[model samples]
Target: MGRIVAKVTVANPVDKSKSRTFDALVDTGASMLTLPTNWKKDLGDLAETRIAKVEFADQNIREIEICGPVSIQIEGFQKIFSEVAFLEMNTSDGMYEPLIGYIPLEQSGILVDMLGHRLKAAKYLDLK
Candidate 1:
């Protein structure tokens, strides 16, 4: 199986607020969307507060925060609200931009078609 890369836009849903739109790697392993600390200022007067520890690709664990509610929108799809983390913006290592993780996927009820590189709502499984 191959990987599918998707474009995601993260925005603070407030009047006259600026949003960050970029290409993000859809990582099912991640539980939430991680943003850069630089985005903190853009989040407006909202302060970025630490919440939990996050393990990076280097295997180093760092304190992560639930900065604010984010509006994650994919092309031709509805925007979803998610708790995000504020991390340092570094690209020297090979990691995707603002990793779109499972939390967003589940909240959005979207399943990715790995082979076809598409997004679709999942069908419910009934045990009955």
Candidate 2:
């Protein structure tokens, strides 16, 4: 499967004014919304940070900073409450690639439509 991308808005729950929208990658393999480390200050007033160990696709493991209780809104979907995992990541040309993962998508009842190459609203939420 190729890459799937989405437009996402991340905001401070209490202060919606502190929000930033980005062209985020749809990465189901990732556990939560991941943003560039720089975003923490942009989406300010975040809660204290905690550390989590991450294993990359290349099999490299590193500890990263995780923060937030930020609101996530993937275009065409309802907003969902979630945290942001900040990784010092960049593309080959030095561009940051923010990503929205499975947790937020499931929270908003959105399903990946990889066959159609777009996101679709889920028929029903899972409780099982």
Candidate 3:
């Protein structure tokens, strides 16, 4: 089986004036938008904080504070005030940066093309 990757956009919305946008893979299995720890500070400091525990694939659970209002944009749609997870690791590498998971996708009402590896407006998919 080959690897499946979905391209998505993540932005720091705290400083709307200097907001930054970057692309990342869409991990459908992920529950929230995951970003590099630095992004939390880069977006002009943490906006909000919440106490939550995240479980990893290996059954390892880590306590995390989700700070956000981080915005997510995809295929011309944008979801403002999107809640995201401030992960411990920086995923900014070649072809892989951070991830926009099902959270924003559901909020924006977009459909994931599992085989095509692309995003389409949910309305488009609804017609099919």
- Report the number of clashing residue pairs per model: 0, 0, 0
RMSD of 2: 1.4
Candidate 3 residue-wise lDDT, 10-102, digit = tens: 556646654556666677888887776666655676566787888888898987668767666665775656777877773455333577777
Q: If scored against the real structure, what TM-score would every candidate get? A: 0.78, 0.92, 0.76
Once superposed on the true structure, which residue ranges of model 2 sit more than 4 Å away at CA? 92-94
Per-residue accuracy of model 2 over 45-107 as CA lDDT, tens digit each: 888569999998899998888887888889979888878899887678867888788888899
Cα error of candidate 1 at position 64, Å: 1.5
The parts of candidate 3 lying over 4 Å away from their true place are 1-14, 90-96, 124-128
lDDT against the true structure, each candidate? 0.71, 0.87, 0.67
Best by lDDT: 2
The per-residue C-alpha lDDT of model 3 at residue 32 equals 81
